[model samples]
Target chain A: MKKNDIIVIVLVAFLALGIGGYYFATRTESKNAKVVIEVNGQLYKEVNLYEDQKVEIETSNNHKNVLEIKDGYASMVEADCSDQICVHQRAIHYNGETIVCLPHLIMVTVQSDEEYSVDSVAN
Target chain B: MSSKKTATFGVLVALAFIFSYVESTIPFNFAVPGMKLGFANIIVLVTLYLLGSKEAFVISMIRIILVGFTFGNLNTMMYSLAGGLLSFAVMALAKRFDGFSIWGVSVLGAIFHNVGQVAVAMLVLQTSALIGYLPFLLVFGIISGVVIGIVGAELTKRLRVILKV
Candidate 1:
């Protein structure tokens, strides 16, 4: 491989690994976290993680997402998106963890009170 | 452009549309929602080399619109448009650089394609949290990009001799 080829390969590898390491390393699990749901990028609902709750978020544009909080973990129990990827994703129960339904433009995140001050992403 | 050139562009566009449809029919998922083997890109890369970026851009635009209207939904169209445009731009720029071959340019195109879709996702969702998925997407992009790059490079090399552009 040429020097440029090597550089490009190494660059992509390092960028992915470095950012991935930082992302996962900084993610913390907090028992007292809150499940925050945002619809169309606006705050639609927020509830404590410990509460066993099923929040159905419906957007004005006919999209729907159901957020289920159980056993201190939050998951997208249901969504109207064609892919169903959000519904199939694993539960999120840690700080900075998010379950996103791209089609519905819905997001479900877990954050502790300390970390709840507008997630780094929200900013 | 000559009628012959127009015919070539039409054929390339048709090929790209067919490849994209075939790709969508593949059963297995890449684990990442927006990721794909991008067989359609091979045509785009080949067109870029055989014809020119202008013709390739036209082909890419038509492929997205035609395929989007027929087999896919508006959501699919939006993501494809956002991703295709960026991928086209990146590949066009990367192709101009001698240090990077078709392989590198194709890879860069793949990477930028993912970036563009993720950016749209972030905007649609209005949450940076979705950016969290970038790592997974990027890792996938690298593997797929390299594969696309190699295939694109080989295809471009072989086709150039036959087309004699």
Candidate 2:
């Protein structure tokens, strides 16, 4: 590779690392985090992350996703969507962490109670 | 366009479509959603260098649509289109600038591809929190882009001599 090519690669790598580092440093573990689930950009459910439960979300389009919350973490255990990308994603427990199922238009986000309340107030 | 050029475009599109199919079957189990090896991009990059940016764009679009119908759904197709368009735009601009080598252009395309896909995800899901996933996707994009760039540059060199373009 030429000098310019190496420079571009390094710049991109550094930029990615910087953004990733910022997110990592800002991620705060919350004791009162809540798992907020949304379907089609609309709020579907909000449950305490500490409370272990399974949320079955079926969209109007017949797409289905099974979200399981346990041990202060939330994950998609099952999805009828062909890609199954959400099902294979890692669980989220820290505030601002998210699991998204694009086909089903489902998003599960972990937000602290304070942030959740602020979000609700804004909405 | 010359008939030979048209035939080459058709063959490139078919090759890109097959690459998409091959990539889908590989079962990339990276926990990050929407992450891909971007194998089909190799063909797109080669086309960009061999033919032209406009030809490359046409091939990329056709490949995405064809693969979408055969192995993906509308949602997937939308994501692919978003990624493909953005990726192609960036690569074409980089080529025009001529500041970087083929590897640099390929890396940029790969990185922007993920960015475009994530942008669509944020819009469709209506949650900016998905931005948190950008770093992981970016890192993966760089790795995959480098590999594809190596293969693409080699193929472009071989094809130029064979096609005498």
lDDT of 2 by residue, B64-110 (tens): 99998999888789999999999999999999999978998999999
Regions of candidate 1 where Cα sits further than 4 Å from its true position: A115-123, B28-31
TM-scores of the models, in the given order?
0.88, 0.95
lDDT of 1 at A63: 82
Deviation in Å, model 1, residue A117 alpha carbon: 11
User: What's every prediction's RMSD, in angstroms?
Assistant: 3.8, 2.5
* Model 2 bad stretches (over 4 Å): A115-123
Model 2 has a DockQ score of 0.73
State the number of backbone clashes in model 2: 0
Report the C-alpha lDDT of model 1 over B49-136, residue by residue, as the tens digit. 8888988899999999999998878987999999999999988988777788777787788888888988888777766776777777
| Residue pairs in candidate 1 whose N, alpha carbon or C atoms collide under 3 angstroms | none
Q: Count the backbone clashes (under 3 Å) in each candidate.
A: 0, 0
Best by DockQ: 2
